[model samples]
Target: MTDLQIGNHLRKLRFLKGEMTQAQLSKNVGVTRQTIVALETSRYAPSLELAMKLACVFDCGVDDLFFWINLEDAKSKYSSDGQ
Candidate 1:
């Protein structure tokens, strides 16, 4: 299975939730701003806990906010049944 990057959706979700900044979301989600930026740019793929926190902030599900956008093809391969 291919490893998928979910960064682009993170940024979209952040903006859709109100153009929130990486720093603000990072603080809310208890991660570094650099981490948030990384998540937004495909430099990082968040762990399950971090992904859940982000979903919570966006008032959405983990899959809703991160698993099926940006790199949907890559994500689809790994999101189900833990691959």
Candidate 2:
């Protein structure tokens, strides 16, 4: 199976927003600072509600923040059938 991963641009967005701090963003999103850190580091994935809150904070859509990375090879060698 492909090792799909979720990536985000939270750190960049925060910096773009006048160097917004993790603590401030956490407070605005009602999450712990550690949660913000985790999100920025791609160590944790946010819930849909949290994602929406973040999008609202930056006035951007969720697609602007998060993206998917498919870690599978071109031929999908990990799969039984490389279709």
TM-scores of the models, in the given order? Answer: 0.70, 0.83
lDDT by residue for model 1 (1-83), tens:
55444544777777777888888998998999999877777778788998888888888888877653445665676788585
**lDDT score, candidate 2, position 22:** 96
Q: What is the lDDT of candidate 2?
A: 0.90
Question: Lowest summed-lDDT stretch of 10 residues in model 1?
Answer: 1-10
* Model 2 stretches astray by more than 4 angstroms: 73-83
Per-model root-mean-square deviation over C-alphas: 7.7, 5.2
Candidate 2 C-alpha error for residue 73, in Å: 5.3
Which has the greatest TM-score?
2
Off by over 4 Å in 1: 1-4, 68-83
Q: Of the candidates shown, which would achieve the greatest lDDT relative to the real structure? A: 2
Per-residue CA lDDT of model 2 for 1-83, tens digit only, reads 76877789999999999999999999999999999999987789899999999999999999999988776752365675755
